[model samples]
Target: MNNNPRQLAFIILQEIHRKQAFADFALDKYLRKNDLIDANRRLVTELVYGCVRRERSLDAIIDELAKKKSHQQNPDLRIILHIGLYQLSYLEQIPESAAVDTTVELAKQNKF
Candidate 1:
């Protein structure tokens, strides 16, 4: 799997959803284990927690835009889309291009 912040966020989401893991615990575990730089660590934290916080709304959007329902989408792709949509809708400081590019890269990695 890819190791960029976006990819890491997707993995964290997968752990939370698939393993029924606590968001904070999964995030902290990955943060500690990965040796990510400060910016990436912060981004991962934001994406993981942000996605968790806004999951319902994000899924609503996913349901509208995606051909497949959220549950039917690849788990990895769902998480990646969550991160991308979260960044687009909530984190205005992030450039749209960067968010879309990273998310697309993540989807590609997962063969979405």
Candidate 2:
């Protein structure tokens, strides 16, 4: 499957969730398999690590914004939201609009 950084991040997140895979291992495996450019690969790495590290806080934001607990969400949707929120909340260099738009597209493309 063709994957942008956000899409790749979504897949990595799902792998982590479903397989209970180690976050670093899953991210590295996927990044190595994909043809993503260096920048996108870096973004995917950051998103995967950031989401895993801040999972509790990210879920809290999801809960507050969506009014649904993370466990209550579709797994893909939860992961997408976490990626978007992580970028928005932590990555000062990324524009807010880009983060949100890419995240929404990732969800739509994944049929979430």
Candidate 3:
């Protein structure tokens, strides 16, 4: 699995989505498996929990901005959007460009 915090968070979110897994459990599972620095671990935890907490709001935002509604989007793509938007909307310290660029890179990495 990728060690990038965003990528790790994305995978945790995907597992939550596809397996109906609990967010905390999935997050803990991944965190245990990956050797992340404290900051990266916090970032992964924040991204996963924040995105899960704000899922409906994120979906609404995606619906408003995307030609495809959130539900209509590919699951992976929607998760990627959630990661990016979560950072943009909630993480004040993260530069907007970093969030957008990293999310775009994730999409490319996944061949979306």
Candidate 4:
């Protein structure tokens, strides 16, 4: 679509969060449906799987960061936290500011 890699990742995360679909299946289906090519397709692949794999730990970090006793947030916020923390913990090549800003923006846009 018109969105960048990070934005696409965020949208995919939301879809996975909302649809209750398997991340791999959803990502694969999405990849095949979209016009993503070459490295960007690879980025989307990594983005989806990486975020899904580390979802629990990401939730813990986000709960801690938000100073909460537990992760009792909405599913959309869960998606946001998962991607944000995935980038924070693993995607070291991407700047932390970009990750956090985009995650917050995505959450806001989704009304999370």
Q: Which candidate ranks first by lDDT, i.e. highest?
A: 3
Candidate 4: where are CA atoms >4 Å away?
Answer: none
Error in Å for residue 10 of model 4? 3.3
How would you encode candidate 2's per-residue C-alpha lDDT over 1-112 as one tens digit per residue?
Answer: 5457888888888999999999989998888889988888888889999999999999998888887788899887888889999999999989999888888887788787
5: Cα error in model 1, Å: 1.0
- Among residues 3 or more apart in sequence or in different chains, the pairs in candidate 1 whose N, CA or C atoms overlap within 3 Å are none
TM-scores of all predicted structures: 0.91, 0.93, 0.97, 0.78
Which sequence of candidate numbers ranks them by TM-score, best first?
3, 2, 1, 4
Question: Candidate 4, clashing residue pairs?
Answer: none
Query: What C-alpha lDDT values do all the predictions have?
Result: 0.88, 0.88, 0.95, 0.74
Model 1 worst lDDT window (10 residues): 1-10
lDDT (Cα, tens digit) per residue for candidate 3, span 1-112:
5679998998999999999999989999999999999999999999999999999999999999999999999999999999999999999999999998999999998898
- What would the per-residue lDDT of candidate 1 be over residues 1-112, giving only the tens digit for each residue? 3358887888888999999999999998888778788988988899999999999999999999989999788777778889999999999999999889988888888887
For residues 19-80, what per-residue lDDT tens digits would candidate 4 score against the true structure?
Answer: 77888887776776678768878777787899888877777787677755335776666666
- What are the RMSD figures for all models against the true structure? 1.7, 1.3, 0.7, 2.3
Evaluate candidate 4 by giving its C-alpha RMSD to the native, one decimal: 2.3
